[model samples]
Target chain A: MTTAADSTVQSAPVRPFAQALKDAQTRITTHMDARLGGDDALHAAMRYAVTGGKMLRGFLVLESARLHGVAEAATLEAALAIECIHAYSLVHDDLPCMDDDDLRRGQPTVHRKWDESMAVLAGDSLQTFAFELLADPRIGPHGLTLIRGLAQASGKDGMVSGQMLDIAAETATRPLDLEQITHLQNRKTGCLISWSATAGAVMAGADEAPLRRYADALGLAFQIADDILDVEGDAAKVGKAVRKDADAGKATFVSLLGLDAAKKRAKTLMEQACDALTPYGDAAETLKDTARFVISRDS
Target chain B: MTTAADSTVQSAPVRPFAQALKDAQTRITTHMDARLGGDDALHAAMRYAVTGGKMLRGFLVLESARLHGVAEAATLEAALAIECIHAYSLVHDDLPCMDDDDLRRGQPTVHRKWDESMAVLAGDSLQTFAFELLADPRIGPHGLTLIRGLAQASGKDGMVSGQMLDIAAETATRPLDLEQITHLQNRKTGCLISWSATAGAVMAGADEAPLRRYADALGLAFQIADDILDVEGDAAKVGKAVRKDADAGKATFVSLLGLDAAKKRAKTLMEQACDALTPYGDAAETLKDTARFVISRDS
Candidate 1:
């Protein structure tokens, strides 16, 4: 499901910003390669778990830093940590005991590629690596702030709690209301994305309140669009199972609000996302385009 | 099985050092209860995971801190974080997809009491909390040092990587040599124990190399003793499914070297552990006792 944001990068002159993002990821890839150093099987699992992904969170961190007019080297290290944590979460989320999805980013999930235990350890190690990278003295004290934000967003109060709520919601007999579904989605998916943005702002030294507002809107908008895609997306283009929400009997925005209302809600949230960035004016144009790309694109 | 050390405390008035250790654990338990807040299921899992263990790692942290003359307030926080990581590892290790143990510390495993998914998330959250607690400013710069030591010891170079090796070793047809088995045991069991001691020393501003060496020797001796117990332990007393190692044909120290040789090795390692602490003199008696306990105790 390539978006206008993705295609624009494909067709246009590769902006230095995009190239910088690539270079940053390349550096992370190298660092991660060394971190997971061992025999072929372990290294393969580690690389496979991280190398393929939406990289949306990475995009968010990079764009957020750009918005703040800071290109500090430490910001790149922080962005890499955010991406590593995001990747680790996805790997664990797809385990057989969890979401049980066999495919991610058009490839077999980590557990399917290796085994469940290896996948678990790989995910666990990658997660630890995120904090290690953030705490590296070479990256300076800036890493501590990054680590704190990630810990809050990924730990009990953030993604893990959201996952518990989502799984419980799946098992419940009663139909969840829109707010209930939204709340679950906001925590499960929105929190990490929100952290990605806010972490970048912290790395670039942006104002606290405005960054929080921007992150909150962007996260919710991203999740609403994701729910919309699960309903309307093409399996061939999406490269994974679609409509699993209906199949799993889980409550989703489309299920709770109807497709038309879901679409309307998604657009409204995307508008809110864009509005949240208004404080940065032209500095946030790319992020605004990303919000539209999120809501309007079809797989 | 109850140990001589535990029985000694039961019989006599609690020594001031032992009282301090209890006080440290109590403080940590109280803080955990407060932070547990409203998540009853998670809180229950956290409490269950943390409460019944021998407290060997926590003891090391407190005792090592006492040896270094660290302030009581700071040592307690360090103990909390170290214990949290240790507990989290145990909960995850006992999951059905991992060791598949039904009982731990004479009680139902977290996965047995809760569901597998909840168990996984609970462990994940606990691991995050450990780092978050260490990153708190109250511990100052030393907190980061403690966290770094912990992350390395518990991550790729430590427990997780060791678990991977243990899992692989279970199915291997070739006999594992002493070196390979020792490597696996060192990483698997030794790493975290060493981290606990070193981290305690770091908390007390003993970031020198000699203290780290002391911790390492203690860690190795601890695992050799654990292997010895697994071979000869009474299931009723140990409160665990005994003989899993022999049943699985795993190559442990007892299996590879025989019980007599394994016991001799433990004794030798204990002597080395004691020798390593000579520089700290009488202040390190508790650590020396810990090394002796590692080899001599049942459970």
Candidate 2:
């Protein structure tokens, strides 16, 4: 029952949230810069492609890691790995052969800044780097688990599968029903979001069943909220392409269920997501608020 | 001291090599089928792209694992992972945005067979799957090390770096010297090939330093042989798009130093590659033979 505005004021404004978020961004960029330092063009492409994104995935990872008491340096590797995978997906998704967008995060896409081939290699390098980061000895065997979890979320059965479905939906003669649209979005966008959160919890050493349920609910809720915002949000606020879904005639929550119904579904999902976090006491309170922010934010 | 025809005769005779190779092909396809169910087009891309190629990388893995006394089951996952990475690389390399090649191993490229988007996703899926395979619990903590070694070989500092240099080489006004060209080819092609052998050895619990040295020498020797073959080999023998290197005016051993000097350099490299196996006694003879076969073979 805790509303977003109330929690924003009542909780000492989550002092660490903004700084932690900044730290995560810095960590991600530092690793990215070091990894892609060979050529000036390559470095510029990697930089232009990665900067200015809303760190939603990073937030999920850091919040979840914090909830699980995973303060050790070992956990930083896992957190960075999650962000790298997310960034790689975005880079590829923006290619001319895929989404074909000229801008990402309010700047020229990698292909726009550099050539398409360089962009392709940049994304490829980034994706490979994610696994390499996790394989670092500092994280020990936990890095292995993180790598496996990420591969599952990002590979064929998860994100890639979702993308194929999205591509199919674009050309399908029959309009996708609510169930089908939800299924596609859940896999396409939600899988990694969920994985980011659950990876943190798992790093914290949370039990398997609770982690599964928590990730599943949080992932779905996050996507629904994102879909809702895509229809009503500002491009300046989101710092990326907005309403492009509608422009592309892509199946979305607003299209299938109408804005009112979509809003209702998002609220319901948010409650389910919060309920999944209830047993963790005050340690998980910020995660619950974060879920609300995911829905209610202008972006 | 060994020669190509002698090594060919020693390599399980033509009959057994055919049969065992066929069996290995069956095993690989069956494993892929089980992993990627029949429903997805991504699976189709994976199946069509991975199967039927010459299992040279697989041969490296199996021979090295056997040399290190690894059980078949223990090495299967690592071997599969190596092949997946190799397949993924070929798929991307053949993309219209990259090499723009139309044929691979005498079959239509994945992008030509399917659409470009599906080919990209298939390659991406296969790449991630390689890491997942290495991270399999069945492989244990050594799985982590194996994944790291493979990822490092395929990543920015390794294979991808080689690719960037390759792209730049096409436009460079100054012809690269022998060392630069050798470094490029070794990193571009040899890194992954070396990884194929090193991964098998790692999974088999070989000593790290020795395995690393062996993989390095074998990789360089393999590239040297490839450069020699590119100058003089026929397409019917190589089963690949031959002589494209010369057509592109790319920097290579043959281009930099002419055919005879290139051949002699290859011999020196082959000897170095073979000498790397001294630590493992007669057990590593097949792998050593493989190194010699790599440089000495016409194909």
Query: Quality of candidate 1's docking, in CAPRI categories?
Result: medium
Q: How far is candidate 1 from the true structure (C-alpha RMSD, Å)?
A: 4.1
Clashing pairs in 2: none
lDDT of 1 by residue, A108-145 (tens): 89888788887778888777877877777755655666
**DockQ metric, candidate 1:** 0.62
Per-residue accuracy of model 1 over B113-224 as CA lDDT, tens digit each: 8888878888888888777777776666676677777888888778888988888887888868899988988888888878777765687676556667876777777777
**DockQ comparisons of all candidates to the true complex:** 0.62, 0.74
Off by over 4 Å in 2: A1-23, A27-40, B1-26, B296-299
> What class would a CAPRI assessor give candidate 2's docking?
medium
Candidate 1 Cα outliers beyond 4 Å, as residue runs = A1-31, A34-40, A69-72, B1-24
lDDT of 1: 0.73
